[model samples]
Target: MPQPSSARLHEFRIVSNDKIAQDIFSLVIEAPQLAKTIKPGQFMNFEVPGNAMSLLRIPLSFARADADAGTVEIWYAVVGDGTERLSRMKPGDTSTVLGPGGKGWGVPAECSRALLVGGGIGVPPLVPLAAELARAGIPFDVCLGAKTASELVGESELDALGAQTLSVATDDGTEGHCGFVTDLAAELLQQGGYDYVATCGPGVMMQKVAEAALAAGAYCEASLERMMSCGFGACSTCNVETTEGMKGACMCGPVFDASKVVVW
Candidate 1:
């Protein structure tokens, strides 16, 4: 009941197949139909063509959605089997992509100023959200964490969208900031004046942002990365424990109010 039982596998094209870093890729998917409703934190379930070896689907986040162009983007890193196969694809090659699925960027319009934090592959999805914020005349800041300078994915796009692109690395002499992205996020939250915070990245990074937002009395929402078997709610692997109980990340979230999630 979380989403339609099934949707057609619309067209999929790979805009960029080059590795941003050692294991990262900027894979952009073009799904025209789904673009209209695609939101900030939402994700899509994709079926890379010529693959009968894996499970039913692979879920990817809604990195960016352009309705005018009739396409949705997924800036993903080659993680495992599914992603690695996807990374090898080129433009005009089709994929059985079915979505705009999952809980979307829970960016409330009531808040005018916010912070968007992403880690390596996590940076792409925030680009559309930043663009949305820009269209709304809302100001936002962005902090991205990568192991090194080469791993940073969407710097130019984020900058073009009007987000004050704050890039960080484990090494201090790299770019904008250094150390864990969580540290940069912590500083931004403590420095004050943000209405809310939105984060999508590694779970630990999102958790840190949530902690900072909670202590500061500002709302925080996160998009999580989980192993989802059935991109819809049929499989339970994507479920996470929350204050309200367990909710499936594929359905109830890819995005959730940090306050509702119970971190053990």
Candidate 2:
């Protein structure tokens, strides 16, 4: 786990901010030091301008980090006031950010095969993990889910990263399998070659993925989303109930051993 001291506040400038899907935006920022240090599942808290009254920064996970280009790419859904403000920021807008927060994925040394499951906006963090797996010569598969075809993101990017098999499920039957992504995940887990599984999504979706991974005898890690009022551990707003006890997401995790988590 990364300590509060390891996470630094850096000045960042928006390189590009574009609407990629319905109510979803892809934001690229120039944060050279952050781009170089951020890990696959680590998150950043951005100080969006124009919200003078709102004190909380928007916490987001990056989809990609290009160290050579000194850029970090984030994919986020415009769900609230902060994000709505973030969506409006033009290129060249400048702000400050706190990152690389918390621990990232802990892929086992013997992991030869892996499975990644994501749903809705939760897909962003998994994208970089897929790239890491590919670079390590680990063949993996992906299962993605969205409410509708227009809401889905990251399939193309994951495919580009060489996922052995990419499957999708949409609630409305507007895309791939007409059901929960858990259906695809369960089927894949049953095939039995994966040694590790990583998932991020709605609580219910991640819980299901965790169950399936456990039954398949694979080690599973999940990135949990919580209300992080403070980017650091001071606020205690992002506490997650684990078997060990309650731990703050901003410091102890956004990622945790699936089996150790008590509450979804």
Candidate 3:
């Protein structure tokens, strides 16, 4: 079952911002009131002023919430009108955000070892989840894949959290390894110590990661991407067919177990 969004709009101030890559922009959204309750695996839908190209709420994963700082950070790749609008927003620009939506990454304190995998724009939400695992003193590893080495984001930040970051690229002659993030995942799983695999990326990439995890007998989870409207469960745009049946990413998930996702 899917749920509706609790907030119609959350007033936030952009305190600081920067670029992580060609299309990626990271922003610090000041929203003290919401940060306190935001948990890992959650997202916020934003209302971008209607422009000529598109008119719909853009729902993005909640990258990180600095509760103490009264701010939250989200990394988005400028692909279309909504994201382009968000990317153009400068410091002090006011934004209307909604949610803490979906059930985010599942990080169990007692789990043996955790592996986080991210690809392209899909990598944003997992950053904070990695940070949380680090805060819990949980030994974890992260494998990130992108087209080129320069495209990889949050490596240093993840490292600061004590995660052994593995960077991979398709060109092979780049950085850590030359292959898919799923390739890195297979190599790590070979070491044979992981208890969980959580990921977000191109669905094709995640499907491969999930396959690898399933082969290794590790628990796996993932956040999904889809066309959305209503920012909540009301619209059925983001529904996914699972083993149990259909579920909405806007309500029941943006994140779900790898076992539940129906790949087609």
Candidate 4:
């Protein structure tokens, strides 16, 4: 069995909160201890403030972490009551968080070039992964897509990282490329040279990316975003169909080998 997040519950104070695009928002939290241990691809279960109706905590992937300043960041879209309440919170408000949950991406030490792909809200987690790769001196590129330009976030941030290449796609034809991000992935794969691929997004997008990666003979992994009531394996709502049978995404992975998962 894959390991679980630490049992420790962290009380984090909201340091900064701002709406970046549309209903999307960015949150920087003060959690000195948790920041040090948090890893890329891991998620945090936030105790939503004033959410009396919804008993479940909100799970968000770490967008960035600053160990030096003792801060952890997350990006979210206001889709429901829980997130609506979170957006109303002030800087000094405090919330409980249980995290660095689930298995994460392993940096490809042997690969010279890697591709990181993210779509819409899925873009957040890839930010930290890019940072980690940069620190490890792994050359990489980023491919980001969204339904529309307004829903997109983090292009400039990824560009600022000095990635080898950057590609963007939008369904509306308002930016970089028109049509699906998977189309872009297919094009990049045809060009070759990327030995590794990591992606997170809608299921359809990920499935296409996986197929392209396999055809290109590149190793690939994906982060699944399922309905997880509990950030741990107890709830069983996050089980994924894999070659090894059903596995708890919260415990085994939000990250999984792209080829091993049943994407249909």
Residue 206 displacement (Å), model 2 = 0.4
Flag regions of model 1 displaced more than 4 Å: 1-8, 13-16, 165-167, 171-173
Candidate 3 structure quality by residue, lDDT tens digits, 64-183: 788898888888888877777777778888968887777777775568788998887788888788888877777788888888776778777777778865555544546667777888
Q: For every model shown, what is its TM-score relative to the native structure?
A: 0.90, 0.98, 0.93, 0.97
**Clash count per candidate:** 2, 0, 3, 0
Q: Candidate order by lDDT, highest to lowest?
A: 2, 4, 3, 1
Worst 10 residues of 1 by lDDT: 1-10
Candidate number with greatest lDDT:
2
Best by TM-score: 2
Q: Give the TM-score of candidate 1.
A: 0.90
Angstrom error of the Cα, residue 251, model 1: value is 0.8
List the lowest-lDDT window of 10 residues for candidate 3: 165-174
Estimate, for each residue in 1-264, the C-alpha lDDT of model 4 and write its tens digit.
778456368999999889999899999999998899998998888898795668898889988899999999889999999889999988999989988789889766788789999999999989998998898888898889999999999899998887888999999998989988888889998899989999999998998899999999999999999888988889899989999899988989999999999943
How many clashing residue pairs, candidate 1? 2
The C-alpha lDDT values of all candidates are 0.76, 0.94, 0.80, 0.89
lDDT of 3: 0.80
Rate residue 214 of model 3 by lDDT: 86
